[model samples]
Target chain A: MKLREQLTALLTSLAGVWIMSYAWIVLKLGSIHVPDAGFLPFLCGAALAVLGVAWLLALHWTKRKEAPAEKRLWHRPLSSLLLMIAYGWAMETLGYISSTLVFVIAWQQIVEKEKWAKTLSIAVLSTLAMYALFVHLLKVPIPSEFFLR
Target chain B: MDIFSGLLDGFAIALTATNLLFCLLGAIIGTAIGVLPGLGPAATIALLLPITYVIGTPVTAIIMMAGIFYGAMYGGSTTSILLNLPGEAASVVTCIDGYQMAKKGRAGAALGIAAIGSFVAGTLAVVGLTMFAPPLAEFALDFGPPEYFALTTLGLLLAVTLSGGSIIKGLIILLFGLILAMVGLDPISGKIRFTFGSIGLQGGFDFVTLAMGVFGLGEILYNLESTMKTEIVTTKLGKVFPTLGDWADSRWAICRGSVIGFFVGIIPGGGAVISSLASYAIEKKYSQHPEEFGQGAIQGVAGPESANNAASSSSFIPLLTLGIPGNAAIAMIFAALMIQGITPGPFLVAEHPDVFWGVIASMYVGNVMLLVLNLPLVGLWVQMLRVPYGILAPVIVLFTTIGVYSTQNQVFDIYAMLFFAAVGYLMRKLDFDPAPLPLAFVLGPLVERSLRQSLLLSGGDPAIFVSRPISGILMVIFVLLIVGQTIFFLRRKWKRRCCVPVPPETEKSL
Candidate 1:
């Protein structure tokens, strides 16, 4: 099986166990009112368990007949992933304006590799538009400290 | 005279310079986004929602957003007709005939046919909506959990049929999506089921980020690899305007698509996507030369493109009349409406005539605005495809991430989007349709909520669900569908297995 197929199987089994565990958790909480707080969760758990079981069985049946060719399905876009992580970390710390500008520029240059003129223009303009939108227009509470500093 | 009298009041509101401006702007922006790949109605609306929150009146805010959806439907065809690439998922079928006609140096004819077909379909669907909406809403007013569950079941079954592939795999994907939906906090109890302890896991996946990332970013990746290997298109650009004959030939196809689409749009879930696909299938089945369907037939583009617009327009029927969203975009509109303290259900017509009628009137105005804005703008959209894929690729991905994160300013939503993007990409690679998965995910909670509520309302008895005539009828349909499909599946498989004869022996005997 391919890595994704294996991962899917693993996830399916774990989901089954997780659901059964929830059922146990809800079942332990004894019923109080006519319709208990735990009732819905219990019902959901049952449904989830059923779904997980079916998923597992379905994957098994499909995969058994023909194992997926052992190959990487997609190229991991690492640059993009790390960029998003940096963007998140920088968002509040860098504040909306500085962070958004930095994030947009970094992606444009590193990932997109656009001409400097185009990248810089998009960075400046989009940041300004977003800034105007969130702060000046909507009156959304955005910290301007990163830019001012 | 009955509704027309009230409609005059609507025209009075919709015709206001500001409302007209908003309608035109909405359609223009919507069409622009639709023509440019990596953007869809849902994503555009979701990303732009923050702007609407700043605007006045929920109705006008919604009318503007709704305008964009239909406008995009019109503009999406520009690329599908000009280049083979579809501007949106729903317009994929259009590429077959639309680009084929374009390749044959009839680009003008193809574009003209698409535009006229969409206009006709949209108008007919609106008329259908005018006649049918209020009555349908009134009927929906009586719905409870049981009825909703039945509707959801019907939607699931139809989705499987509509999505071409192995039926079993489609069902499995849908079920998987539903289970994924269950991962977040349980609505009734507020207990987290599938949250693996991190704070990010609580809210569940946002559909927009998943859609844009997979469809947009993944598409870019695929294109980059493919473009590197293949010979690029070097055909000299030809006459851009379509001929009158193109428009006339597609009128019947457009009308048929529109009528089919409007009815399909009335359903509770994933109506627009379903409508476009169904219309294409029906059109192809009815076509004289079905062989030309996937090979660039103008009718292929005209019918499906028109159906998409018609469906997008008619989707308003469910949202306006029944207080139900047929898809996520409408769901956001429902959110905005509730924020404005305007209830959207049966009494909305009587209680909020200005909001209701004004929005309805704006749609009529918006349709005209969209066509005018889109037809001339086709040239601009086709040029977008000429931009180098490598450069445009990352920018699309970044924007999608930001858009999703902006929704709640939550990192969790970003992760949820990422996870689901992977799921979406996998589904795409495997030829499993992502359409049904989202529909299944959204409908899962509804099914659970209604079933529980029904059982509780019945004092712990399941019979209450079966007791209501409407509920019982719907349940029978659901049961019959499952039973029917199972039989059909077995028969098909059996026939395929048994129909074989040795080729060599048969040839020799002959």
Candidate 2:
């Protein structure tokens, strides 16, 4: 937790530095007489950097005794996030229906450990329902990139 | 126009069969989402925004959307009472006394009072909206670019201060939002700012996608972190209706909450959660039997429930009149209206009276429908809670992905949603509030335009902000708020230093 806090502060400061550098290099900062696109970004980046430094100093001054805990790389949420990313990637390749069916079934079966029959039925039904609702009723053209083509 | 005549015209539009049906549907869906944990009105509205494209008119679409907002407030109290799981942030306070009431076999009474109080408050808030919004809009017509710049600045500042976290973190998030809003073409220059030379970035991030990601998919991801199963209380509901004595004990609290909520809702960044918290604190402070609080006090449930509902309804005032969304939910509605080619502002009432008044009138119908829908259909909502998070989470992710994709049929939006969802999750873990981010994002372009316009109007004189009366007053208030907060922070620090006993090593080091 302590390490995480320090890392957060460090990352925030780095982000601030990046913002300032980007604005200075890429965007033209107009004179104070006439502010330009980069004005707010530059000011905000400076403030963020100062705030990050202040936060770090405050943490140091508090000096609370705490130990860093073992950091778990992957948790349930991270797994879910990965699943969502995979779903997004596969949707264009496999198309909406097949991708949705596969993702939903995989989630229910593997992540949730639900019954196979229940997972398959739910995934299929939900996909069909979404198709009817979005495609038929709403007239939204979801990507049929692969299968329906 | 007279309020009565305007409202009557509104009813004429609202009472149409199609509009009424959509209003009912919105209410039902709103209650369902509100009863379920890990979903909120903002996310639900964003997820369903694509449907608004199919609606015939902006009036019907906005009526349905408005119904969902207040209806969620009405339904949020149910899970808070029955399952001790606050369906949304606004209902978190309700869990204290409401769940206790359920333990004492008064779940039905608590739910009943909550519905009644919400109905009363929502209806009264609609009346307030009808009477107040037009005049406010009329007054807002006098606002120039300088005034608007001040107003948006004040709104962002208020959101950060009231977000109830580290001010610096809130500002950082707000700046991040502003930076994100800087994506796509500069509205003024027509030059792309942060697109990194990508065609997908040219249109900027879709508002609906961002909302669905942060509030919907992000929330689901966060909830998945907790693998522990929720133990729902299986208390058999006693009376579906509150007893006459329950009403007697809570009638004043309901009224007080309604007033408090209506006023608070008008303030930018003041939404249902803040209103409910304020109402609960005020009710407890003034109650004769304060000990009854957190121990199944009927007033506790009634006050906050009513306040949140009223706040939800009244929060529409700023959005409808000033084109400023008080919170994320209203921001989604703003985006929805903009999508429909209707810009909400001082001219909304004059230009699109049907959409404005129709929505107000639908709230009256929607609130009554919610009262009927919540009381009899509460058992259904409770059954909805039985659906495991495992099944529900993936469904949410699927819906969000589908919803974002369907918006422009762009797969890039799905990727954007995932990125924001990750950002949202990280923000939660880092103790930074994401509430101000969306609000700032919504207001960012407006702030930039107004600021640039004001500067141009004044030949780059920054004093243009202070030279105008309305803008000057707003700027003064903004400065005072900052100064007051800084003084308060220093005073607290000083008090802590004076109060805490120093250890020998620390004193020696000092």
Best candidate according to TM-score: 2
- At residue B405, give the lDDT of candidate 1: 60
Q: Tell me the interface RMSD of model 1, in angstroms.
A: 8.5
- Candidate 2 lDDT over A1-149, as tens digits, reads 44676677777788888888877777766765566777667777777787777667655555444344334333777877888889988988888888999999888866777898899888988888888877888787876759458
Clashing pairs in 2: none
**Candidate topping lDDT:** 2
Candidate 2's residue-wise lDDT over B11-49, tens digit each? 999999999999999999889888887788998897888
After TM-score superposition, what is the CA distance of residue B276 in candidate 1 from its true location, in Å?
4.1
Which DockQ-derived CAPRI band holds candidate 2?
A: acceptable
Candidate 1 C-alpha lDDT tens digits along B1-510:
246766778889889887887788788877876776656666566556555656787767877887877888887777776657667767887877877776777676677677767777887777776667667766877888778777666767666665555565566566665666666677777777666676666776554554444544444443433322222233534554455666666667788788778877766554566777888898889888899787767678778878887888788887788665666556556555765677777778778888777877787787777666656655665666676555455555555555556656666556666555555555655545555565566566776677667766777777776789888888887788778877876565465447853232111000
Clashes of 2: 0
TM, every model: 0.83, 0.95
The reply for model 2, stretches above 4 Å from the true place, is A62-74, A145-148, B500-510
Deviation in Å, model 2, residue B345 alpha carbon: 1.2
